[model samples]
Target: MELTPPEFTDYDTRLGAYAVIVRDDHVLLALWDEPEVPILMWSLPGGGVELDETPAEGAVREVREETGYDVELTGLLGVETFVMAPEKRFARVGDRPQKNVQVVYEATVTGGELTHEVGGSTSEARWIPLAEVPALERIGLIRKFIG
Candidate 1:
């Protein structure tokens, strides 16, 4: 099969807000299914910040969508920045670097059930043991929160 680049514009950029939700020895994570890979990559449960929402609000919303858990922000963890070039695995267009500004927060689950996001970026939600996280295929953001 031949691989071609996806479409993008020079103005494309993204602002994301993610959360670290931990209880006991487990952390909440989402499974991201890559079309080009056989194994699913793991990431923290969160996504892009909406135009009308604050990063904190977006964190709460994303966590709920990805993990089926209503969470309350406990603290601001840190910000991680990524610049994706066109030749990167995720980028389809190389006109400009896609600067991803990621804001992470520490949160606690207040309500909701364990579920997966439907028609979303992630396919499954799981609470994985902290000791096993290092062996998992994950996005760079995972290191920012755990490390």
Candidate 2:
């Protein structure tokens, strides 16, 4: 979530969808490597929901785009809402506190070869051992999946 001083009257809110794809003793994670953003971390393969798509559809599409794996969304895991001030780490177009709503879902890999996401926020998709997740440097959102 990104927040900044409210510069406009209209509320600034964004919707995002993510997937928790786990298999055997490993969990799927994407290496987020946004240009000009110094913060790099391993996170679930998902992104902002498109205007014409449902959250579930968005989750599936995002996972495929970021992880190069087709997925079937099984169930909604949870929804999280957060507001934060946007700074250099979370800059946006408007200087307003952004309300971010995240929808998390449980998904399973259906098909597709493992490949890096081209021209996207995430560069690599990997199935990391579950036991090693705790020690990895990642965004706080990771707790939602591992826990």
Candidate 3:
């Protein structure tokens, strides 16, 4: 039997906000354990920014949801973007290419304790040391911005 790869014909853009929160040389990250996708990744604590809310607000909300931390953004860490093929997406369906526009910022944890998310894209959250991050499996964004 002969087979061919599916042709990518659709395109979409997603706006996400992320925070780089460092404390005692460790970075706060979320474990993305979506069942549909086979790859497990550790990424910054953040997610899609809703239409009505600003990116900053989304960052705070996502951080709280994924990492159980209340954070205050300290400064902008510049914008980053990438085009992901269908098979590589974490949240979006695997049908077409997705352009991810990410707004990253520096933040500080103000309240809440370290806790894992229950029923979300991420299953666990942790504060991984900077020196140990390289050994763990991470998403592309982590390499670009963090380490």
Top model by TM-score, which number? 2
Which 10 consecutive residues of model 3 have the lowest summed lDDT?
A: 87-96
lDDT of 2 by residue, 1-147 (tens): 888875855446789999999999899999998876677889888989999999999999999999889999998889998876655325576666778899999999999989999998999999999999998878666886674
Models 1 onward score TM values of 0.85, 0.88, 0.85
Q: Can you list the residue pairs that collide in candidate 3?
A: none
Per-residue lDDT, model 2, residue 105, is 93
lDDT (tens digit, per residue) of candidate 3 on 1-147: 889987865788899999999999999999998897678989999999999999999999999999999999999998998898987876667588898899999999999999999988899999899999888899877887888
Off by over 4 Å in 1: 1-11, 34-39, 89-94
The lDDT, on a scale of 0 to 1, for candidate 1 is 0.88
Best by lDDT: 3
Error of 2 at 136 (Å): 1.1
- The TM-score of predicted model 1 comes to 0.85
Question: For model 1, how does the per-residue alpha-carbon lDDT over 16-131 read when each residue is reduced to its tens digit?
Answer: 99999999989999998757546688999898899999999999999999999999999999998877775663647646668789999999999999999998889999999999
- In model 1, what are the clashing residue pairs, if there are any? none
Candidate 1, residue 24: Cα displacement in angstroms equals 1.2
Q: Which ten residues in a row have the lowest lDDT in candidate 1?
A: 86-95
Ranking by lDDT: 3, 1, 2
